[model samples]
Target: MAISLSAARLAVKSPLIAQPDPSHTVWSRLEPLATSDDVSDSLQARIADPLWMLARQWQFNELQGEDAGSPISAALAVVGLPVSTLLHQQNAVDAVTLPAGAAAIEALVEHEQVLSVHPKLNAQAGQQLMRRLRAAGLPDAGQVLRAQFPAALPAPDDAVADNAGFVWHMLLDQRAIDAQALASTLKALPDRAALEAFTSGLGVAAAQVGSAADLLSHWLGWLDELALDGSAPGASPYWQPQRLEYSFALGAQGDGPPVRLQADEYADGRLDWHSFTLGAAANLPGGPSEAFDVPPKDAPPPRPPLPTTARYPGMPADRYWEFEDGRVNFGMLGAAKSDLTRLAVLEYALVFSNDWFTLPLTLPTNALYRVSQFDVRDNFGITLTIPPAGWNMFEMSLQPGAPVARLDNALYLCPALNTLEGPPLEHVLLVRDEMANLVWGIEKRVQGASGEAIDRKFESTRLSTNQTLRPSADAPANGALLQYTLQTPVAANWVPFLPVRKEGATPANWAIQLQRGVVTHYYQVTASRLADPVNLRYSAFIERLRSNRFVETTGVQGAVDNQLQGFMFHPRGSLLRLDPNAPVASDFLRVEEEEVPRDGIELKRRFNYARDAQGRALLWIGRSKTTGRGEGASGLKFDVVTRGKV
Candidate 1:
C-alpha cells in the first residue's frame, strides 16, 4: 500500500523574506541574568553597562571614607656642614684641620707608597717625564734630564739610601751614561731661566728648551701631589691604621663633641653616618655656651646654625588614570606562604601604589645634614608640619644593648668615593681546626718589599728545602730508614691562637678569648753513647738541639714598620680590640670566640682610588670580608710516630 501511494509530486512555491530596515529598530537593552547566584555571573551579564565598573569598585571597598588630603607642595629646611677637623687616637693626642676637597682625606686613609724615594717608582716617574719631553721635540731628553736634575746620592751608610739608587740606570744604558760623573758635575740651576740657559748651551733650540722646562715643572708638580706623608701628624691626625679607627669633628669651628668612626665595623668600602659614635662630651675652657648670660654649667648646649630652606623635588603624583609601567607584571609574580617580602611588595604595587609618595632631597657629598623643618601643603588648603623624630627610612639603626641614645635625624653624605679597587694585596684566612681544637690565622698572601703580593705557601715551600735536617751520624742504622717523631712541623704561615679566659670573668661565666701564640720548631740530634754508660742517663744518649729551634712569631709583619699595612682579619663577633694606649699592644689583639668560626672566613686589604664629582683624586686602603672555603687542616699533631722520613 505504501508503494501505491507514490503518485506524481506537485511543486509548491515558497515566499522570499527581506532584511529589516535600519530605522525601524526599537530601543535596545541588555537582559538581566535569570539567576545571580554567582557574583561572576552578574558581572559577566552587565559588563557592557557603564555602571558595572562602579559596582565592582564598591564591592572591593574602593569607596571607603578617609580624612587624608593629597600633598600639593612641600618645603624643607636643612642644615649642612662639612667635616672641619680630625682628631687621631682615642686619647685625642693630635688634631688637624681638614683640607679642601678630598686630598687630605685620601692622605689619611691610604698608606704612603713612596717610602723613601723608591728607585723603581722614581725611575718609572722619570721615564714618563722623558717620554713627554721626547714628544715635545727633544731626542736626547734623558741625558739632558739627568744633567739638569742630578741625582742626590746619599752616603753609603745613610738609612735613607737603603732603597734608593740612580734612577737613570733603568732608562739609559749603564755603559753609555756615567752616574758618578753626572752626580759630580752638578749644575745649580735653581730657576727656569737658568735651566733654559743651561740647555741652550748644549745646542738645543730655545723653544724646545722652554717646552722641556715646562714638562719638568709639570712632572715635579705631579710628584709633589702624589707624595703624601701618611705618618705626618697634621696630615693623618686621627687615623689609626692598626685599629682602623678615627675620630673627627664636623662643625665649622670644630666645637662639637668628636665623632668616632671605626672602619672595621662592616669591613666594606662605603662609610656613612651610621659609622659614627658620639664621644664623651667635650669640656672646653671657654666654650660658646660660656659667652651666654647664663652660667656655663647651667646653660643649654649650643644649638646648630639656622638651616637653608628649599622646595622639595621629585615628588610623586596620585592619579587614578595615571599610566603605569606594564613591564612590572604583578599578576605573574609567584610567592610562597613564607615570602613576606614578596607579598608586601605585591600589596604595595596593587593596593597602595598611589597612596605612597616619594620626595627626593639632595645634599652635597662629604657633608652632614639635619632636617630642621619639613612643611607640606595639601590641595585642600591644609598645612602639615613634620618633625624629625628619627622616623625616616634612612635613619641610623641603634645598636642592641647600647647605652647611647638613638641617633638624631642627621644624614651624612659620605665622601663621593667611587673607588676602583685593585686586586687584594693581602689575604688572610682565619680558620678553626676541630681536630687540634685551635684557631689559626693563615697568611695566604703578604706584601713583599716591592709592594707585590707574595704567596706565603710558595715562600714556605722554598724556605723548607733549606731547613731540612739530616739524620744524626750517631743514630742507629735503622733510624735512617724509619724515624719516630714526637710531632710534625707546622706550616710557617699558619700562626696559632691559644684560647684563654677573660681577665675579669667569673668561674661560671668565663668567656674564652683567642690570644696570639707562637710555634717553636725543635731539632733532635743523637750524640754518641756517653763514654761512661753507667754514669750518664738516657738524656746523654739523645741530645735535644734546643738552641737550634726556630721560633715563629704570631701576626704577619708587612714592609712598613709600626703601621699595620695590608692587614685583614675576619671578625664575626665582637671586633678584635687594638688599644694603642694599652700597656702592651700584643695583649689587646685578643679576639672573641665568635669571631673565629669553624667554617672559616677570609679578609682582604686592597688599594682603592677614585675621582669625585669635583675632580678631586681620592685614594684609600680598604678591607673586605668574604666567606671562605669550608674548614682547613693545619697538619699539626702532638706525640705522633711516623715510619717515613720526617
Candidate 2:
C-alpha cells in the first residue's frame, strides 16, 4: 500500500502538465529535446502524474479564452458563464483579505443599513410600541406589597400594614389592569395640563399601593381577569413569531370573563398592568435586554431607491470601454428627438484606448461584435461574439448563471439588436490626464511588446465634461442616457461618441431570439430576492443549512471562494426541459423575426421597457390555432403573459 500510494502521489501532478487535448502531438512533447533517451524519461514522468489520468478521462481541451490560470476565466469557462463576471467574481473573493479593521468598518456600515431600514422603527408603529413598554415599567413594587403583604405598604395605617403581614393570603373583589399598556398610554399622552376638560386619573391605580395585601390582592385579581394563553411563552396561538419576537401577554383578556394568577418562571412571563415592575419597564421595545437606542421619535429616516429603479445608462451597442458608475446604478439612455423609422437597427461603439483620444464606433453595416482590449491602468474589458448568429452564450444567469458576474464586475453587452449586418466602426481612442503621476506611469508601461504600442495623437479640441450628462427630453428620444465613470482617469484624450439614442437606434438587448414564434426549447431562469429576508439562509441562525440545499443558498461567501466553488461541485440546481414558445413584450422596441407554425406563430419582440406598478415588463405571448396570415387579411387576437421572475 505504501509503494502504491507513492506512485499515485507522483502521478497526481501529470494531468496538470499534460497536453489536455490528446490530438495535439506537438503539445504533448514531454521529453527533453537534447536526446531521445531524455525525451522518453520526460514522457514517463508525464504518465506518472495523477492529474494526467483526469486529463485523459475527461479529454480536457484548451480553447482560446482569457488565461486558463486566471481565476475568473477558469471559473467562467467551467460553468459556461460570462466573462463580464470576472472582475466582480474575483473581487468578491479578494475583498475578504482586507485588514480586520477595514472588515469591521464594513460591518458597521451594514449594521447602519439595517438600523435605518428596519420596518419597526417607523413613527406610526414605534410610538405605540414604546408606550406599551413604558407601561410595563411603571407600577411600584409597593403596590404588590400592599395588595399581598400590607406590612410593606405605605400610608397612615401603620397598624393595618403591620397586621396584614401575618395574613399573606388576601381576599378581594379585584378589577383588572394591563399595567404595561396602561402605564405606557399614560406616559405617552401630553401633560395632563394639555388634556381637555375630562380630568380624572384611575384612582384605583393610585390607591392600590396602600398595603402589601391590597397590592397582592389587586395583582392576583388582574391575573385572574387575564384569559389563558396556551401557546409557548412569547407566542400567539394564531400568529407565527417574527424573529426575536415576543408577546408579553396573549389570550390574557380574550374570553368571557376574569381569572387569577398562574405563574411559572420559565413560562413566557406576563407583567401586571398596574404592577410596579410592569409600569417601570414601559416605554421600551424588547423590554430591557433587547432594547435599542433609538433616535428621537419625530425624525424620519431617509432612503435610496433600489438600483433597478435608479436612472442608469444602458451599455453601448458594441465592445467599448466608456465609463460607467464605479458603484451600483441602473442605466439611463441619453435619447435624442428624431424620426428613425427609415433606419435599421444600428450598433454604435465607444472603445477606450490607453493612448488614443476617445473614438466612436461606426456602424459600417452590422453589429460590431468585437473583443477589443481596453486598459484600466491594470485591467481589461471585451465583448465575445458567437458565430453563425442566433446562439445563446450564457449557460446560467443567476448563480453560476450568465457570467456569474460578481456585484461590481465589468459588463460587455454584445450581439446587440439590429436589422442590418456588417463590421462596426472602431471607436476613436484618446489619452489625457488629471494628475501628472498617472500620465508618467502609462508612459513607462508603454514599452513596445507584441508589436502593440500605446501611441497617442493629440488635438487642440475643447471638450465639455458634461457633453453626455444631460440629453434633450422628448418621447421615445427621452431614452438617452447619462455617462458614468468606472475609474477616474487622471487625464486622457478620450474619444467622443454620440450618446443619444434615435428611433432606429440599435440597443444592447438583455435577451435575444431568432426566427419568431412558439417552439419546443430547454431553458433555465434565475430567481433571487431583491431584499434580505430576516429568516432562512441567514448566518445568525444555525437551522439554516439543514434546509433543502435544493432550495436556498446561505449568504454567499466572498466572490472569489464563490467562483472557486464552481457549479460542478455545487448542490444540484433546478433542471427543466420543455419546448415553449419564445416570449413577446408589450413595450415594442424591435421585432427580430416572425414565423407561423402548425400550432402557433412565434413572434420575436423587443419591448420599449414600460413596466407595471410592481416594476415588471409585460411580455405578450401570442398564440393562434391557424397558420400563415399573408398580406394582412385578418390578424390574430393578442395573448399576453408577462415575463419576469419573483
- Report the number of the highest-TM-score candidate: 1
Predicted candidate 1 versus true structure: per-residue lDDT over 443-522, tens digit per residue:
77654433345565654443231243333355465535566666677775676778998689898898888876655553
Cα miss at 199, model 1 (Å)?
Answer: 8.7
Q: Candidate 1: which stretches are off by over 4 Å?
A: 1-74, 104-107, 114-122, 137-141, 144-213, 224-229, 232-266, 281-360, 376-385, 389-408, 448-450, 458-483, 499-601, 624-631, 642-646
Task: Please write out the lDDT profile of model 2 over residues 1-646, one tens digit for every residue.
Answer: 3356355665556664543655534332222233321222322224546676656434322322434221111001100111111101112231222221121111111111111111111121223322332354424432332233221111111112123312211211111222332333434556434221111222223333233233333443442222121212211221111111112211111111111111111111112212111111112111211111121111111321111211224433222223554352212222222423311111122222212222232211101012223221112333233232222232111222222132112112221222221111111111112221111101111101111111211110111111111221332443324433332222112211111233443576433212111111111111121112422222212221123121123333344312211111111100010111111211111212121122222111111112222332222111111222222111111232333332
**lDDT, candidate 1, at 82:** 57
Best by lDDT: 1
Worst 10 residues of 1 by lDDT: 565-574
TM-score of each candidate?
0.56, 0.14
TM match of model 2 to true structure: 0.14
For candidate 1, give the lDDT.
0.49
Local lDDT at 280 for model 1: 35
User: Model 2, residue 581: displacement in angstroms?
Assistant: 50
